[model samples]
Target: MQRGKPLPQKEVAQRMEVSERWYRNLESNAGAPLTPEALIRLSTALALGPDERLALYRHVHANTKLGEPEPDGPEEARSALTHLLATHERYPAYIVDHAWNMLDCTDPMADWFPWVREPEANLLRWALTAPEAREQLTDWPRHAALYLAQLRFALVSSRDNRQLGALLDEVLADPECRRLWDEETKVVAYRQGHRFRLRLPHVSAREITVTSQVLLPAHRQELRYVLLLPESDPAPLPNRGERDPAQCRS
Candidate 1:
């Protein structure tokens, strides 16, 4: 179960067909070496989040050192971001640095990209250059402008940093980006609790809310966590003409 879920031990015991005490021991790390079969049962029983499940596995089996240092350079950052992308399989998650450079993403992101499998894909590039992405976005121009503004705000705030300045320069060099940059636009920090619609491929248009929570004191840059949550439980699309195609398209 996820960290704050209630009565996880009881739930695990019921699912595993084991007594509550035995299940509690496993969760509490009292069991010295959880057998492979036992671990699988625990993982399923607990319905653990990816991070939680991985933490449990590492604790019992890998003998790996816990919590490597925060990734310092681009390579290390990419490696860390890739792990996060892989872990959040069900949800589409992407990582951006202080300057809002898209670092890594998951397979579900492919719903917005024809080149989903490409290495080193950047969100800005996709938003501005990719025709598929443009079509997928309900309000492409507004979304593109908002992100560019966010990037500009980040650049202004972190101008002294060499890496960030270089990224800004690279983005500005693009013709479409250059055109947008020339517009005298004001950057309004996205208000908390703002939600919007996104047209994801193969899925009917869904409302996704954006929440900005901050992680701070990690050196010169502040890390912002952008969560994309479905506004409602998405109804599955009918395979063919079972439903009105026009309504579903909207």
Candidate 2:
């Protein structure tokens, strides 16, 4: 209301189709009850930008439903990944929800990353809990910190998620993970590449550098693809000749 050449409250109230007294009440109390739709109108009338709009959502929807990035259904997310899986056949890739659960993956991803194929698997949970991870990731401790930091960031947007809460419970139970989280370091979401050293399914132990990235689908912000691209041609690549049918399925 008082940004620039202040517009009259009466006219503002009239434009919003609300009584001036009600508008005054809203202006006075920041905690006033507001539906999501009403907040949109209010944000726009105030000429709030995208960030301000989110701030409004964070405030108004604090105890109720989340504001934006409304997710596509899990099944729909799964169906969408089939196309993505086939497209990224040369690289290891898997899709995950905000909760970090693996919704789908390319065959090479399932072959190379054992955790992705496991049922009820979450990327964060797997990294922090899997015994194999300690040996697989050359930089386990640092990567763990980054992954946990990312989880903490996601929680701000999804305070009411039961599954995330349960996941938090399980994470807090782990002494090492809890300690790192307790430190409250500003690690944020994992976005960069990492060097991995692991014993393969059939091949000899291998060390490879792979970068991982998250891709949000056009229609759904929650459904994201975590892709691992090799930094360079891996030594003695999977199969010197034709790729294995079982390992590189489309």
Most accurate candidate by TM-score: 2
> For every model shown, what is its TM-score relative to the native structure?
0.48, 0.64
**TM-score, cand. 2:** 0.64
Q: Report the lDDT tens digits of candidate 2 across residue range 1-250.
A: 1245666778767767778887777878845556666787787777765544564565455566435664557567657766777888887788777788877777767767756656677888888877787767777787778777667656655677788888888887889889988775342543635444444534223576677776776655566777888776555645546555443221
- Predicted structure with the largest lDDT when compared to the true one: 2
What digit string (tens of lDDT, one per residue) describes model 1 on residues 94-202? Answer: 5555655454555444443435345555555666666776666667777767667655555444446786576667767777677877773434343235455666536
RMSD of 2: 9.0
lDDT of each: 0.55, 0.67
Pairs that clash in candidate 2:
none
Candidate 2: residue 70 Cα off by (Å): 8.6
Question: In model 1, what are the clashing residue pairs, if there are any?
Answer: 1-46
Model 2 lDDT, residue 89, Cα = 80
